[model samples]
Target: MGAMASRGFDHIDTWVFDLDNTLYPAHHDLWQQIDMRMKGYISALLGIAPEDAFVIQKDYYRRYGTSLRGLMIEHGIDADAFLDHVHDVDLSTLDQEPRLAQMIDALPGRKLVYTNGSERHARNVLARLGMEGQFDAVHDIVAGAFHPKPTAEAYQRFLASHEVNAGRAAMFEDLARNLEVPHELGMVTVLVTAPGEGEAVRESWELEGREARYVDHVTTDLTAFLEQLHLQR
Candidate 1:
């Protein structure tokens, strides 16, 4: 770990973690299911082919921060229905990580799950990981009024709702772009990376800028990172 990475959480009283890949290993392919569902939903909604829908999905995700957002803006799709459909994936593939649960529990102060997905999906994921009730609160797309992360407005709304001091907080996210706003807001930002490659869930553009100055830390294993913090404190 670098110097900043080692001591960055010393003053952090609030730990905000992104769901999906950030909480669980990306190799599990859980998000891949959601990604496919998203494409399917878009294809069915627009009466287009899957490949064509995929292009629009990625384009929307790149331009609007989320595909659902783009769909709403362009086609007036029902956000709730879209979220429900996309998140309806099998959690049986995910195994409970007791070590991760323990490490997260050991952290001091408030813990929160901030996700662009629905609260129901976040809860299901937590239950699958045996981490239910570990977080003080969950701020989902509904809570943010459909504004997703990487957007300054969404971050501001989250901070205001939680009464969190950005300087004393730390955020963990799988996507580098999602951490940009948190870093700019003075939160210690940790980019959680997964092993292997050729994952369709995350795009090449989404994984860009991993070495950006805004990212304070980067870790491939979230459990080990938290364990190190436990020892440091």
Candidate 2:
């Protein structure tokens, strides 16, 4: 069954997933809390009004791969300080969960986190989900590593460092653009759909002129998706 099933899919030996929206449901409104903190940081750093800073931060995040990266090149911003400032979120509102952890423990391949977020951000999310020990690897946004996702350069570097066989690895992410490179690289791509509270961000999921097929699968919830995947296909 393992051999035939493996062949049925694209020989999935490595499964890499995104951390943020892909790991937790949007209905939790965790991102909203985090966003406010990030905006606040931006305002304080640039000495601008909070509202104006939100626009500036988003603009830089869009124009460049990450706001910190843009800030690094343009303003000589301190990367560590920026990450510390932006990620200051209260996780007390979040409770530890074991639902997804079991599913991940059952998956039959090497698992890794390939995210543009820092290690601290990933750690917080994983711990909250009771999945702190699941992944075999976690990549962070630091020190000229890989270009970070949504860009070809970062994807290329990610695969290279992991020694990933694209034919055998699966890449899961919430961002459409980030998965596009993995799809083209022959990695199976899974898009985690927004559960709730993200209707306003729907347009952000679409990649312009992305025709035919780029995603192998899509799910509205992470743990639900993993539960199904664990079953015999």
User: In TM-score terms, which candidate is top?
Assistant: 1
lDDT of 2 at 86: 69
For candidate 1, report its TM-score. 0.96
Q: How does each model score on lDDT?
A: 0.90, 0.72
Candidate 2 matches the true fold with a TM-score of 0.87
Best by lDDT: 1
lDDT of 2: 0.72
lDDT tens per residue, model 2, 1-233? 01122223436789898887777765566667767777887788789999998888777777777777777777887788877776777666665658877777777778989878788888887887788899988877862362567788887777777888988888877776777788898887777766453447544434332232676676676777777666645
In model 1, what lDDT does residue 191 have? Answer: 86
- How well does candidate 2 score on lDDT at residue 136? 89
lDDT of 1 by residue, 79-139 (tens): 9899989999999999999999999998999999999999999999999999997899999
Range of the 10 consecutive residues with the lowest summed lDDT in candidate 2? 1-10
Which sections of candidate 2 miss by over 4 Å?
1-10, 143-146, 196-212
Q: How does model 1 fare in lDDT?
A: 0.90
List where candidate 1 sits over 4 angstroms from the true fold: 1-7, 198-201
